[model samples]
Target: MANKYQRILLKLSGEALLGEQGHGIDADILDQYAEEIKAVQAEGIEVCVVIGGGNIFRGVKGATAGMDRVQGDYMGMLATMINSMALQDALERKNVHTRLMSAIRMEEIAEPYIRRRAIRHLEKGRVVMFGAGTGNPYFTTDTAASLRAIEIEADVILKGTRVDGIYDSDPEKNKDAVKFDTITGDEVLNKRLNVMDLTAFTLCRDNKTPIIVFNMNIKGNLKKVVCENQSIGSTVVWDQ
Candidate 1:
Protein backbone atom coordinates (compact mmCIF):
# COMPACT_ATOMS: atom_id res chain seq x y z
CA MET A 1 0.00 0.00 0.00
CA ALA A 2 2.85 2.40 -0.62
CA ASN A 3 1.83 5.68 -2.25
CA LYS A 4 2.65 9.36 -2.58
CA TYR A 5 -0.80 10.86 -2.08
CA GLN A 6 -2.21 10.70 1.43
CA ARG A 7 -5.55 12.18 0.49
CA ILE A 8 -7.58 12.20 -2.71
CA LEU A 9 -10.92 13.30 -4.15
CA LEU A 10 -12.70 10.64 -6.20
CA LYS A 11 -15.36 11.85 -8.62
CA LEU A 12 -17.83 9.31 -10.00
CA SER A 13 -20.49 10.03 -12.57
CA GLY A 14 -24.05 8.98 -11.77
CA GLU A 15 -24.21 7.21 -15.10
CA ALA A 16 -21.52 4.95 -13.71
CA LEU A 17 -23.85 4.12 -10.86
CA LEU A 18 -26.38 2.79 -13.33
CA GLY A 19 -24.03 -0.10 -14.22
CA GLU A 20 -25.51 -2.26 -16.99
CA GLN A 21 -29.09 -1.17 -16.30
CA GLY A 22 -30.78 1.32 -18.58
CA HIS A 23 -31.64 3.49 -15.55
CA GLY A 24 -31.03 3.84 -11.81
CA ILE A 25 -28.42 2.00 -9.72
CA ASP A 26 -27.05 -1.50 -10.06
CA ALA A 27 -26.45 -3.26 -6.78
CA ASP A 28 -23.46 -5.19 -8.06
CA ILE A 29 -21.58 -2.08 -9.17
CA LEU A 30 -22.18 -0.42 -5.83
CA ASP A 31 -20.82 -3.45 -4.05
CA GLN A 32 -17.74 -3.48 -6.28
CA TYR A 33 -17.07 0.22 -5.68
CA ALA A 34 -17.45 -0.27 -1.97
CA GLU A 35 -14.87 -3.06 -2.01
CA GLU A 36 -12.43 -1.06 -4.12
CA ILE A 37 -12.76 1.99 -1.88
CA LYS A 38 -12.40 -0.17 1.19
CA ALA A 39 -9.09 -1.44 -0.17
CA VAL A 40 -7.83 2.12 -0.69
CA GLN A 41 -8.96 3.19 2.77
CA ALA A 42 -7.14 0.21 4.21
CA GLU A 43 -4.00 1.70 2.67
CA GLY A 44 -4.55 4.81 4.83
CA ILE A 45 -5.38 7.22 2.02
CA GLU A 46 -8.16 9.63 2.93
CA VAL A 47 -10.96 9.61 0.37
CA CYS A 48 -13.52 12.23 -0.55
CA VAL A 49 -16.24 11.72 -3.12
CA VAL A 50 -18.41 13.81 -5.49
CA ILE A 51 -20.88 11.99 -7.74
CA GLY A 52 -22.69 13.39 -10.80
CA GLY A 53 -26.46 13.05 -11.37
CA GLY A 54 -26.72 12.41 -15.12
CA ASN A 55 -27.98 8.88 -14.50
CA ILE A 56 -31.01 10.19 -12.65
CA PHE A 57 -31.35 13.76 -13.94
CA ARG A 58 -29.38 16.39 -15.79
CA GLY A 59 -29.96 20.11 -15.40
CA VAL A 60 -28.71 21.01 -18.86
CA LYS A 61 -30.95 18.38 -20.44
CA GLY A 62 -33.93 19.69 -18.55
CA ALA A 63 -33.13 23.24 -19.63
CA THR A 64 -33.04 22.08 -23.24
CA ALA A 65 -36.56 20.64 -22.70
CA GLY A 66 -37.87 24.09 -21.61
CA MET A 67 -37.67 23.56 -17.88
CA ASP A 68 -36.63 26.49 -15.72
CA ARG A 69 -32.83 26.36 -15.65
CA VAL A 70 -32.59 27.05 -11.94
CA GLN A 71 -35.23 24.51 -11.04
CA GLY A 72 -33.61 21.94 -13.27
CA ASP A 73 -30.24 22.47 -11.62
CA TYR A 74 -31.83 22.13 -8.19
CA MET A 75 -33.34 18.82 -9.21
CA GLY A 76 -29.99 17.69 -10.51
CA MET A 77 -28.42 18.55 -7.19
CA LEU A 78 -31.02 16.47 -5.39
CA ALA A 79 -30.22 13.62 -7.75
CA THR A 80 -26.60 13.77 -6.66
CA MET A 81 -27.78 13.51 -3.08
CA ILE A 82 -29.62 10.33 -3.93
CA ASN A 83 -26.55 8.82 -5.54
CA SER A 84 -24.41 9.86 -2.59
CA MET A 85 -26.77 8.27 -0.11
CA ALA A 86 -26.75 5.06 -2.12
CA LEU A 87 -22.96 5.00 -2.13
CA GLN A 88 -22.87 5.72 1.59
CA ASP A 89 -25.13 2.78 2.30
CA ALA A 90 -23.03 0.49 0.12
CA LEU A 91 -19.78 1.50 1.83
CA GLU A 92 -21.30 1.10 5.29
CA ARG A 93 -22.41 -2.38 4.35
CA LYS A 94 -18.72 -3.20 3.92
CA ASN A 95 -18.00 -1.69 7.35
CA VAL A 96 -16.33 1.36 5.89
CA HIS A 97 -16.83 4.47 8.00
CA THR A 98 -18.31 7.34 5.99
CA ARG A 99 -19.85 10.79 6.43
CA LEU A 100 -22.32 12.13 3.90
CA MET A 101 -22.16 15.94 3.70
CA SER A 102 -24.17 18.30 1.59
CA ALA A 103 -23.43 21.70 0.11
CA ILE A 104 -27.08 22.64 0.51
CA ARG A 105 -28.46 22.22 4.01
CA MET A 106 -30.28 18.94 4.54
CA GLU A 107 -30.09 18.38 8.27
CA GLU A 108 -32.43 15.41 7.98
CA ILE A 109 -30.33 13.47 5.46
CA ALA A 110 -26.74 14.60 5.85
CA GLU A 111 -24.43 16.91 7.71
CA PRO A 112 -24.03 20.46 6.40
CA TYR A 113 -20.58 20.67 4.79
CA ILE A 114 -18.11 22.30 7.17
CA ARG A 115 -14.44 22.54 6.33
CA ARG A 116 -13.18 21.62 9.76
CA ARG A 117 -15.67 18.85 10.25
CA ALA A 118 -14.93 17.32 6.87
CA ILE A 119 -11.20 17.46 7.50
CA ARG A 120 -11.67 15.98 10.94
CA HIS A 121 -13.60 13.09 9.45
CA LEU A 122 -10.77 12.45 7.03
CA GLU A 123 -8.26 12.62 9.85
CA LYS A 124 -10.33 10.09 11.73
CA GLY A 125 -10.27 7.76 8.72
CA ARG A 126 -13.83 8.37 7.63
CA VAL A 127 -14.63 8.74 3.95
CA VAL A 128 -16.57 11.96 3.27
CA MET A 129 -19.22 11.89 0.55
CA PHE A 130 -20.01 15.41 -0.67
CA GLY A 131 -23.44 15.72 -2.24
CA ALA A 132 -25.39 18.67 -3.74
CA GLY A 133 -23.39 20.37 -6.46
CA THR A 134 -22.10 23.73 -5.29
CA GLY A 135 -25.57 24.45 -3.87
CA ASN A 136 -26.22 26.72 -6.86
CA PRO A 137 -27.57 26.66 -10.35
CA TYR A 138 -25.41 26.16 -13.46
CA PHE A 139 -22.61 24.41 -11.60
CA THR A 140 -21.74 20.78 -12.32
CA THR A 141 -20.69 18.22 -9.77
CA ASP A 142 -17.29 18.33 -11.49
CA THR A 143 -16.89 21.87 -10.24
CA ALA A 144 -18.00 20.78 -6.80
CA ALA A 145 -15.32 18.08 -6.79
CA SER A 146 -12.64 20.57 -7.77
CA LEU A 147 -13.77 23.14 -5.20
CA ARG A 148 -13.95 20.61 -2.40
CA ALA A 149 -10.58 19.08 -3.29
CA ILE A 150 -8.97 22.50 -3.13
CA GLU A 151 -10.79 23.40 0.08
CA ILE A 152 -9.63 20.21 1.76
CA GLU A 153 -6.13 20.46 0.25
CA ALA A 154 -6.39 17.07 -1.40
CA ASP A 155 -3.24 15.85 -3.07
CA VAL A 156 -5.06 14.85 -6.23
CA ILE A 157 -8.44 14.22 -7.88
CA LEU A 158 -9.09 10.64 -8.96
CA LYS A 159 -11.59 11.06 -11.79
CA GLY A 160 -13.14 7.63 -12.09
CA THR A 161 -14.74 7.30 -15.51
CA ARG A 162 -15.98 4.57 -17.82
CA VAL A 163 -13.04 5.04 -20.14
CA ASP A 164 -9.61 3.68 -19.39
CA GLY A 165 -8.02 7.13 -19.61
CA ILE A 166 -7.88 10.41 -21.48
CA TYR A 167 -7.44 10.07 -25.20
CA ASP A 168 -7.03 12.33 -28.22
CA SER A 169 -10.59 11.36 -29.25
CA ASP A 170 -13.47 9.30 -27.94
CA PRO A 171 -11.95 5.88 -27.54
CA GLU A 172 -15.24 4.08 -27.96
CA LYS A 173 -15.99 5.73 -31.29
CA ASN A 174 -12.46 6.10 -32.63
CA LYS A 175 -10.30 3.02 -32.50
CA ASP A 176 -7.35 5.18 -33.54
CA ALA A 177 -7.70 7.53 -30.59
CA VAL A 178 -4.30 7.98 -28.97
CA LYS A 179 -4.05 7.77 -25.20
CA PHE A 180 -1.75 9.96 -23.19
CA ASP A 181 -0.04 8.31 -20.26
CA THR A 182 0.62 11.76 -18.89
CA ILE A 183 -0.62 15.16 -19.98
CA THR A 184 -0.48 18.73 -18.84
CA GLY A 185 -3.56 20.64 -17.76
CA ASP A 186 -2.80 23.33 -20.33
CA GLU A 187 -2.50 20.67 -23.02
CA VAL A 188 -5.88 19.26 -22.03
CA LEU A 189 -7.41 22.74 -22.47
CA ASN A 190 -5.50 23.49 -25.66
CA LYS A 191 -6.70 20.22 -27.19
CA ARG A 192 -10.21 20.65 -25.75
CA LEU A 193 -9.98 17.23 -24.19
CA ASN A 194 -13.24 15.96 -22.67
CA VAL A 195 -11.72 15.01 -19.32
CA MET A 196 -13.87 17.48 -17.47
CA ASP A 197 -15.67 20.79 -17.89
CA LEU A 198 -13.62 23.93 -18.55
CA THR A 199 -14.50 25.38 -15.15
CA ALA A 200 -13.46 22.19 -13.35
CA PHE A 201 -10.27 21.81 -15.39
CA THR A 202 -9.42 25.48 -14.93
CA LEU A 203 -9.83 25.20 -11.17
CA CYS A 204 -7.50 22.22 -11.09
CA ARG A 205 -4.99 23.97 -13.32
CA ASP A 206 -4.98 27.11 -11.20
CA ASN A 207 -4.73 25.23 -7.93
CA LYS A 208 -2.10 22.76 -9.18
CA THR A 209 -4.39 19.86 -8.38
CA PRO A 210 -3.19 16.83 -10.30
CA ILE A 211 -5.92 14.60 -11.75
CA ILE A 212 -5.82 10.90 -12.59
CA VAL A 213 -8.49 9.73 -14.99
CA PHE A 214 -9.07 5.98 -14.78
CA ASN A 215 -11.80 3.44 -15.29
CA MET A 216 -13.39 2.77 -11.92
CA ASN A 217 -15.70 0.14 -13.33
CA ILE A 218 -12.71 -2.12 -13.58
CA LYS A 219 -12.21 -4.03 -10.38
CA GLY A 220 -8.95 -3.21 -8.47
CA ASN A 221 -8.21 -0.17 -10.65
CA LEU A 222 -8.88 2.27 -7.83
CA LYS A 223 -6.41 0.59 -5.51
CA LYS A 224 -3.83 0.33 -8.27
CA VAL A 225 -4.13 4.02 -9.13
CA VAL A 226 -4.14 5.28 -5.54
CA CYS A 227 -1.96 2.88 -3.63
CA GLU A 228 0.49 1.64 -6.24
CA ASN A 229 0.53 4.67 -8.56
CA GLN A 230 0.57 2.21 -11.40
CA SER A 231 0.33 3.42 -14.98
CA ILE A 232 -3.34 2.61 -15.29
CA GLY A 233 -4.68 6.00 -16.45
CA SER A 234 -3.99 9.41 -17.96
CA THR A 235 -2.59 11.91 -15.51
CA VAL A 236 -3.30 15.63 -15.94
CA VAL A 237 -1.23 18.06 -13.97
CA TRP A 238 -0.20 21.72 -13.89
CA ASP A 239 3.31 20.63 -14.76
CA GLN A 240 4.63 17.32 -16.05
Candidate 2:
Protein backbone atom coordinates (compact mmCIF):
# COMPACT_ATOMS: atom_id res chain seq x y z
CA MET A 1 0.00 0.00 0.00
CA ALA A 2 1.17 3.52 -0.74
CA ASN A 3 2.05 5.58 2.29
CA LYS A 4 -0.30 8.34 3.51
CA TYR A 5 2.69 10.65 3.79
CA GLN A 6 5.86 10.65 1.74
CA ARG A 7 7.85 12.15 4.58
CA ILE A 8 7.16 12.64 8.28
CA LEU A 9 8.78 14.09 11.38
CA LEU A 10 8.26 12.02 14.51
CA LYS A 11 8.18 13.86 17.84
CA LEU A 12 8.88 11.75 20.89
CA SER A 13 9.22 12.58 24.56
CA GLY A 14 12.48 11.51 26.18
CA GLU A 15 10.41 10.22 29.08
CA ALA A 16 9.05 7.60 26.70
CA LEU A 17 12.52 6.10 26.67
CA LEU A 18 12.31 5.42 30.38
CA GLY A 19 9.74 2.67 29.77
CA GLU A 20 9.12 1.09 33.22
CA GLN A 21 12.50 2.17 34.51
CA GLY A 22 12.87 4.63 37.37
CA HIS A 23 15.32 6.63 35.22
CA GLY A 24 17.43 6.22 32.10
CA ILE A 25 16.53 4.32 28.95
CA ASP A 26 15.22 0.83 28.72
CA ALA A 27 16.82 -1.38 26.11
CA ASP A 28 13.47 -2.94 25.18
CA ILE A 29 11.87 0.40 24.39
CA LEU A 30 14.80 1.42 22.22
CA ASP A 31 14.65 -1.80 20.24
CA GLN A 32 10.88 -1.54 19.85
CA TYR A 33 11.07 2.03 18.58
CA ALA A 34 13.86 1.13 16.19
CA GLU A 35 11.80 -1.73 14.77
CA GLU A 36 8.71 0.44 14.38
CA ILE A 37 10.72 3.10 12.53
CA LYS A 38 12.29 0.47 10.32
CA ALA A 39 8.86 -0.83 9.36
CA VAL A 40 7.69 2.58 8.19
CA GLN A 41 10.95 3.39 6.42
CA ALA A 42 10.74 0.08 4.57
CA GLU A 43 7.53 1.37 3.03
CA GLY A 44 9.54 4.18 1.38
CA ILE A 45 8.46 6.92 3.75
CA GLU A 46 11.05 9.45 4.80
CA VAL A 47 11.43 9.76 8.57
CA CYS A 48 13.05 12.37 10.80
CA VAL A 49 12.78 12.49 14.57
CA VAL A 50 13.02 15.00 17.43
CA ILE A 51 12.95 13.69 20.99
CA GLY A 52 12.51 15.71 24.19
CA GLY A 53 14.96 15.46 27.11
CA GLY A 54 12.57 15.54 30.09
CA ASN A 55 13.63 12.07 31.11
CA ILE A 56 17.09 13.32 32.01
CA PHE A 57 16.49 16.98 32.63
CA ARG A 58 13.81 19.63 32.16
CA GLY A 59 14.92 23.23 32.02
CA VAL A 60 11.69 24.68 33.34
CA LYS A 61 11.81 22.39 36.36
CA GLY A 62 15.35 23.37 37.05
CA ALA A 63 14.56 27.07 36.80
CA THR A 64 11.83 26.69 39.39
CA ALA A 65 14.37 25.00 41.64
CA GLY A 66 16.70 28.06 41.43
CA MET A 67 19.10 26.97 38.69
CA ASP A 68 20.05 29.52 36.02
CA ARG A 69 17.46 29.14 33.28
CA VAL A 70 19.91 29.35 30.41
CA GLN A 71 22.31 26.89 32.01
CA GLY A 72 19.54 24.44 32.77
CA ASP A 73 18.18 24.67 29.25
CA TYR A 74 21.59 23.94 27.74
CA MET A 75 21.89 20.97 30.06
CA GLY A 76 18.49 19.83 28.75
CA MET A 77 19.83 20.09 25.21
CA LEU A 78 22.78 17.83 26.01
CA ALA A 79 20.38 15.33 27.54
CA THR A 80 18.52 15.21 24.24
CA MET A 81 21.78 14.47 22.42
CA ILE A 82 22.36 11.54 24.75
CA ASN A 83 18.92 10.12 23.96
CA SER A 84 19.38 10.74 20.25
CA MET A 85 22.70 8.89 20.22
CA ALA A 86 21.15 5.93 21.99
CA LEU A 87 18.31 5.78 19.48
CA GLN A 88 20.78 6.13 16.61
CA ASP A 89 22.80 3.23 17.94
CA ALA A 90 19.68 1.08 18.26
CA LEU A 91 18.62 1.85 14.68
CA GLU A 92 22.09 1.13 13.35
CA ARG A 93 22.14 -2.21 15.12
CA LYS A 94 18.94 -3.06 13.29
CA ASN A 95 20.70 -2.12 10.02
CA VAL A 96 18.63 1.00 9.52
CA HIS A 97 20.79 3.83 8.20
CA THR A 98 20.61 6.99 10.34
CA ARG A 99 22.23 10.36 10.83
CA LEU A 100 22.47 12.15 14.17
CA MET A 101 22.30 15.89 13.71
CA SER A 102 22.50 18.44 16.47
CA ALA A 103 21.39 22.04 16.66
CA ILE A 104 24.38 22.61 18.97
CA ARG A 105 27.37 21.30 17.06
CA MET A 106 29.47 18.51 18.49
CA GLU A 107 31.39 17.31 15.44
CA GLU A 108 32.93 14.57 17.53
CA ILE A 109 29.48 12.97 18.00
CA ALA A 110 26.89 14.41 15.62
CA GLU A 111 26.90 16.51 12.51
CA PRO A 112 25.78 20.11 12.83
CA TYR A 113 22.18 20.42 11.65
CA ILE A 114 21.94 21.50 8.01
CA ARG A 115 18.59 21.81 6.27
CA ARG A 116 19.64 20.65 2.84
CA ARG A 117 21.78 17.86 4.24
CA ALA A 118 18.92 16.55 6.40
CA ILE A 119 16.55 16.49 3.42
CA ARG A 120 19.17 14.78 1.31
CA HIS A 121 19.68 12.11 3.94
CA LEU A 122 15.93 11.41 3.94
CA GLU A 123 15.97 11.24 0.16
CA LYS A 124 18.61 8.53 0.41
CA GLY A 125 16.44 6.47 2.77
CA ARG A 126 18.29 7.45 5.94
CA VAL A 127 16.49 8.25 9.15
CA VAL A 128 17.62 11.59 10.57
CA MET A 129 17.43 12.18 14.32
CA PHE A 130 17.53 15.85 15.31
CA GLY A 131 18.70 16.66 18.82
CA ALA A 132 19.49 19.74 20.94
CA GLY A 133 16.13 21.49 20.76
CA THR A 134 16.75 24.22 18.18
CA GLY A 135 20.09 25.09 19.85
CA ASN A 136 18.28 27.85 21.67
CA PRO A 137 17.54 28.12 25.34
CA TYR A 138 13.78 28.61 25.98
CA PHE A 139 12.52 26.61 22.98
CA THR A 140 11.16 23.13 23.60
CA THR A 141 11.75 20.01 21.54
CA ASP A 142 8.18 20.32 20.29
CA THR A 143 9.18 23.57 18.61
CA ALA A 144 12.26 21.91 17.24
CA ALA A 145 10.09 19.18 15.72
CA SER A 146 7.82 21.73 14.14
CA LEU A 147 10.72 23.75 12.79
CA ARG A 148 12.45 20.73 11.33
CA ALA A 149 9.24 19.43 9.80
CA ILE A 150 8.63 22.73 8.05
CA GLU A 151 12.26 23.05 6.92
CA ILE A 152 12.22 19.54 5.49
CA GLU A 153 8.75 19.99 3.95
CA ALA A 154 7.46 16.95 5.72
CA ASP A 155 3.88 15.96 4.95
CA VAL A 156 3.05 15.65 8.63
CA ILE A 157 4.36 15.54 12.17
CA LEU A 158 3.72 12.31 14.03
CA LYS A 159 3.71 12.88 17.76
CA GLY A 160 4.21 9.60 19.54
CA THR A 161 2.84 9.55 23.04
CA ARG A 162 1.61 7.09 25.64
CA VAL A 163 -2.01 7.78 24.80
CA ASP A 164 -3.79 6.49 21.74
CA GLY A 165 -4.97 9.99 20.83
CA ILE A 166 -5.83 13.41 22.13
CA TYR A 167 -8.73 13.56 24.57
CA ASP A 168 -11.09 16.22 25.77
CA SER A 169 -9.62 15.52 29.24
CA ASP A 170 -6.83 13.41 30.63
CA PRO A 171 -7.74 9.90 29.54
CA GLU A 172 -5.52 8.30 32.12
CA LYS A 173 -7.43 10.02 34.85
CA ASN A 174 -10.87 10.56 33.35
CA LYS A 175 -12.81 7.47 32.47
CA ASP A 176 -15.33 9.56 30.60
CA ALA A 177 -12.89 11.60 28.62
CA VAL A 178 -13.73 11.93 24.96
CA LYS A 179 -11.31 11.38 22.08
CA PHE A 180 -11.49 13.24 18.80
CA ASP A 181 -10.40 11.36 15.71
CA THR A 182 -9.95 14.67 13.91
CA ILE A 183 -9.70 18.22 15.17
CA THR A 184 -8.84 21.56 13.66
CA GLY A 185 -5.87 23.60 14.77
CA ASP A 186 -8.16 26.44 15.73
CA GLU A 187 -10.34 24.13 17.78
CA VAL A 188 -7.34 22.68 19.53
CA LEU A 189 -6.32 26.17 20.58
CA ASN A 190 -9.83 27.24 21.49
CA LYS A 191 -10.34 24.19 23.65
CA ARG A 192 -6.86 24.66 25.11
CA LEU A 193 -5.95 21.05 24.52
CA ASN A 194 -2.31 20.64 25.44
CA VAL A 195 -1.18 19.18 22.13
CA MET A 196 2.04 21.10 21.79
CA ASP A 197 3.35 24.33 23.27
CA LEU A 198 1.88 27.49 21.78
CA THR A 199 5.00 28.18 19.78
CA ALA A 200 5.10 24.74 18.25
CA PHE A 201 1.36 24.60 17.60
CA THR A 202 1.40 28.03 15.98
CA LEU A 203 4.17 27.06 13.62
CA CYS A 204 2.18 24.09 12.37
CA ARG A 205 -1.02 26.09 12.28
CA ASP A 206 0.54 28.85 10.20
CA ASN A 207 2.39 26.41 7.93
CA LYS A 208 -0.58 24.08 7.38
CA THR A 209 1.34 21.16 8.76
CA PRO A 210 -0.93 18.38 10.00
CA ILE A 211 -0.10 16.49 13.19
CA ILE A 212 -0.95 12.95 14.30
CA VAL A 213 -0.85 12.00 17.96
CA PHE A 214 -0.66 8.27 18.49
CA ASN A 215 0.48 5.60 20.92
CA MET A 216 4.07 4.80 20.08
CA ASN A 217 4.42 2.07 22.68
CA ILE A 218 2.18 -0.18 20.66
CA LYS A 219 4.13 -2.35 18.25
CA GLY A 220 3.26 -1.78 14.56
CA ASN A 221 1.22 1.32 15.34
CA LEU A 222 3.58 3.56 13.42
CA LYS A 223 3.42 1.30 10.39
CA LYS A 224 -0.36 1.22 10.56
CA VAL A 225 -0.56 4.99 10.70
CA VAL A 226 2.04 5.83 8.05
CA CYS A 227 1.88 2.90 5.66
CA GLU A 228 -1.67 1.62 5.80
CA ASN A 229 -3.17 4.99 6.69
CA GLN A 230 -5.15 3.32 9.37
CA SER A 231 -6.97 5.63 11.76
CA ILE A 232 -4.76 4.68 14.64
CA GLY A 233 -4.59 8.15 16.18
CA SER A 234 -6.03 11.62 16.41
CA THR A 235 -5.20 13.94 13.51
CA VAL A 236 -4.96 17.68 13.95
CA VAL A 237 -5.43 19.69 10.78
CA TRP A 238 -5.63 23.32 9.83
CA ASP A 239 -9.23 22.66 8.91
CA GLN A 240 -11.59 19.73 9.25
Best by TM-score: 2
**Candidate 2 per-residue C-alpha lDDT over 123-192 given as tens digits, one digit per residue, 9 for 90 to 100:** 9999999999999999999999999999999999999999999999999999999999999998899999
* Deviating ranges (above 4 Å) for candidate 2: none
Clashing pairs in 1: none
Give one digit per residue, the lDDT tens place, for model 1 in 1-240: 368789999999999989889999999988898899999999999999999999999999999999999999999999999999999999998899999999999999999999999999999999999999899998899999999999999999999999999999999999999999999887888898988898988898889999999999999999888888688889987873
Cα-based RMSD of candidate 1:
1.0
Q: Write down the TM-score of every candidate.
A: 0.98, 0.99
Candidate lDDT values, in order = 0.93, 0.95
User: How many steric clashes does model 1 contain?
Assistant: 0
Model 2 TM-score is 0.99
